[model samples]
Target: MESMNESNLTALAAFNHNEALTKIPTFLFLVLLTPFGIIGNAGVIYVYGCRLKKTNLQHFITLLAVFDIVCCLVAFPLKMVELWLPVMYPSGNLCKVQNSIICFTCVASALTLLIISVDRYKKVCRPTQSQMTLCHAKILFSVITVISLIYSVTAAFIYDRRSIPLDSDGYLVGYTCVMDFNSVVTQGYFLALFVVLVIVLGTMLVLYCLVWKEAKKHFMQSDLRYRHSENQEDGEDHTSPHKRNLHRTNRTVVLISLLFAISFVPSLLVSVLFAQFTHVQFSMTTRTIRELIYGTWALNSSMNPLVYGFCNENFRTEFQNLRIPFGCYGRYPAPKKNDIKSIAQV
Candidate 1:
């Protein structure tokens, strides 16, 4: 009997060690990502919100940065605490708030991406159609905030503190934030979130496909015209700025979408599996996979500024001149009315 008890304790200790090892990735992400996310997103917000002229594109990009900031400041810290002290995370209210903020950021970011795709499609594919204006962007932002808030509140209600058994005898235990797996409503909520994500991603994919097709056709015609132009000087094609900018914008959108897909798909898939197959005992491998996927969220939030800096010339210029130490402000030149109009046509 003593040997049996010793063996059980040994097994529990090994399991605890493994669990701690599995959390290392998440901890590293949170530690490395928090500062970068906060600073990078803050820079984006500063450039778009304070430096540039107010445009639909600026608004949407700023909003995305805002969501990323919330994830970094609120969600990431709570997650780190939860992982570090799985047994003693203050209270259920904190967990609820953390989950709520996570939900809000995810929902808001996805919807904003969808809206940006629609806006890009309209501008690139249908030049004669009405483009999204600043007013329209404001309306859409408010709508998304309200919609996201509603869903997030629902998430807050869905999660609570749950006890985790650390031994076969249930003598050693830990508390963690979790939802009711046995509840049909909880499972259904997760299923609904998954369905919504799929639909949003699908719609964005279609819009981008059409936009790319149109942009390619437009670029080919422009290239042909430039090649045959009588005023071509020194074998230089000067009419390619619009095409370059257009391609850069397209690349930025693609990168953001790809990041979102890579970050969210695995996490959501694991969530769906756990929700739908509650009866199935998840092995250590599965749990480790889930933790790794969850860690990707921080990477996703931290990467958008890099994407913007690398893909957009305007953003790159601003970022280059963003000297923090000297307190000298870098000014982004406001586009002239004609330049704005020409950009809109592109």
Candidate 2:
């Protein structure tokens, strides 16, 4: 009996050793990514919201950065806490709050991207129609905030701390945050979330396709006009500045949406599997995989600034201007009036 008890102790120790190993990499990655996300998103807010002339596109970008910052500031830390002490944390309320806020930020980000797509579609595909105004944009942003809050509340109610068996012998069980997969309501909730994601993605894809078709036709016309005027002596550029700005804005939003889709879909899929398959028991390996998947989603929030820097000239220029306070302010000049006018036209 003593020898059997000793063997159980040895196995439990091994289980813990493996569990820690699995979580460490994800934990460290989040720890490193969090500060960069916070600082980068903050810079985005500063430059677009304050430094640049206020345009609708700038407003959308600023708000999106705000949502991303919440993910980095609130969600990432909660996730790191879960990873660092998965077994010892006992507050169900804290778990619920953590998961709920994470859901809110994610839903808000997705909806913002959808709105950007619609804006692009209207400008490019239906140029003669009435376009979205600043007042309308504000109203829509308020609506998005309310809807995200209401949708995310469900997560707070669904999740709770439960015992996750850590050893095959069932000698060690770790208390972790999760929902009961056996519950019909939980399965339905996940299914609904998945449906929403698919619909949002599908709608964006269709809208972008139509916008691209129209843009191609318009650009071809512009190219022909440019070629026709090339031999003239006036030396005026035939391309419309407003149209050029709109195209650049479209490309930037598309890149951001792609990043979100790539990171978010896999995390949501893993979650749906957990809810749909009741027999899907938690193991250290599976937990590690889930954490890594979530890390990708968190990484998405950090990455948008990089996308902005790469794709948008205005954003890139302002980002350089940010370095000026350290005795380099004279190196980069403020955006010209014509640049601001072009953005305003979009």
lDDT of each: 0.79, 0.77
- How does residue 15 of candidate 2 score in lDDT? 60
lDDT of candidate 1 over 249-307, digit per residue (tens): 88888889888888788887877666667566778677666787867766678888888
Error of 2 at 204 (Å): 0.4
Clashes of each: 0, 0
Kindly report which residue pairs in candidate 1 clash with one another: none
Q: Can you tell me which runs of candidate 2 are displaced by over 4 Å?
A: 1-17, 165-171, 227-243, 276-290, 323-336, 342-346
Model 1 residue 1 lDDT score: 84
| Best model per TM-score | 1
Q: In model 1, how large is the Cα lDDT of residue 285? A: 74
